[model samples]
Target: MMKRIVLCFLLIAFSTSVFSGVADDGAISTGEYDYGIIEWNSRNPSLVVEGGANVIDIRNYGRLEVRYTSIPINGDWYTGGIRDIHLDDYSELLYLDGITDILGIDENATAELKGGSINYIDSMQNTDTKHIDLYCQSGWSWLYDDEDLDGIDEIVGITGLWENDSAFTIGFINDYTFGYDPVYMNINVVEIPEPATLLLFGLGGLALRKRR
Candidate 1:
């Protein structure tokens, strides 16, 4: 009974954390990306960004498949790839939080759930794509140049998602060894305040300090 209670409490805590909001100081702008699955014909990988719904999808080529969409992006497209694959080069990690569903959430949060889709191509065959979508009003935010994983940074994308209030089907598939795992449709979203914004904040802080 104690273990059950603890498990339930842990689940609630995790759920709250997932649904909580972070400040919008460095929030990622709203955007969506979708890529229709393609046959692996030795062509270089291509990505698509859908602005209406704000999602990102990666199409791979194998039995293993994964799709990440309805993620917000504050920076360029290659940001997620650069951070994930080139971690040695870049010292920052991005984050996204306050998401209740793939692209939308209930009113208890700031954003409304919207409909979005993402498609992932299976690696085993030449043609395998998973159609996915995400939608939200204000549930998404991002952080950049984050060296700390203390949930201080904004979110760039989501991982290991299975289901939620929205009707998006998400999960992981195992079809290969370490070298051939399902890849991520990484969304690299970074937020940097403008010089003027920073200056204004600085001035405000100085004023407060003087008054004190």
Candidate 2:
């Protein structure tokens, strides 16, 4: 009986350690927006969502860090090609930083400058008021555009134009994909607890076990 109890305790501790660094899937809204950390650990790791907007009106409140690896392309073309990632005018604030070599915007994509401007950082571009094409496998790009013209910038939409054939998969619990297959990429968001809270919980568990 004592051996079984010790084994159960060990299993519980191991499970907690494995799942402590995950965040939950974020939401996109036109009215009230939910803010949290978004993480993708598949081909790319450490991706976060800051905020943005669109006709649907989804927004975020932090910065997004994207790590890239290999991008998927269709047809007999063995050589890698550029993939276009588009952000609409609804995005209030767009800031992006990460590896940019594997992904890039299609050359034919259009950019419309309305009121604000775009700031390019290394390979990444930051904009507060511009619609542009995003290219992969470059360096890093940050976009700081706002749709509402409000002082705060937020991410409004992750889905690009349907005509452009730009679709990605994001899951809060399990893994899900939207467009395309061969299952190239996936984003997983897991919740993370504060260190202080975790420590206190650990102590409480120990105390309860002792009493039992």
Candidate 3:
């Protein structure tokens, strides 16, 4: 009876800790703008910022996907659009899987990629090619350019745009109209476990097995 009670209590404690860990993973904020949905997935999480300046600060996450859209308010397509997007340095070891259009914006509208080390950037649609500016200090580096092929272009590289720094900033315009009308971004983060934490987990497992 005592063993069963102890086991039940341990299970409950473990479950609570697991849920708490997941709950404290990331954060979402719309500031003063009325954004869309901010969904979280254990494997992949995303944020959608619409029509106005917004900021996303994710300290740690598996992957971060951002869909930024800016539309004209009351047919004012010229002025009422996404002003800028700033990805701070808190997001480390970020990875991007693929690019999918999230929302549509005006042709004259522009978006900026600031901070964080982006492992991969899949595709961009409706963005003005001329306004895409990469900051060297932000560690935004293009590893490989497969522009000659017909399939998806692969711009792969280890280092970012700048040297030493892990984060990068790039600005681009939205120019697509048809199916590719929105800006989509995929970010990946690789988590490295600390040695002390790993050892503690192993010891705990061994203790539980012995107890059973």
Tens digit per residue, CA lDDT, model 1, 30-74: 342212111111112222111221222222221111223233357
lDDT agreement of model 2 with the native: 0.27
What would the per-residue lDDT of candidate 2 be over residues 1-212, giving only the tens digit for each residue?
A: 99999999987775444122323343221222222122222222222322221111112222222212122234211222112223222222222321111222111212221111121111122223222433222122222337647676543222211111222211111112432111111111122344455789999999999999
- Compared with the true structure, what per-residue lDDT tens digits does model 3 show for residues 1-212? 99999999997776544222322334322223323222233335444332232222222332344433344456442333332222322232222211122222222322334333332232333333422222334223434446838676543433443322344432223234454432332212223334455679999999999999
RMSD (Å) per prediction: 20.7, 24.2, 21.7
Model 3, clash count? Answer: 24
Clash statistics: count for each candidate: 39, 50, 24
lDDT of 3 at 62: 28
C-alpha RMSD of candidate 2: 24.2
lDDT of each: 0.27, 0.27, 0.35
Ranking by lDDT: 3, 1, 2
Task: Identify the candidate with maximal lDDT.
Answer: 3
Better of 1 and 3 by lDDT: 3
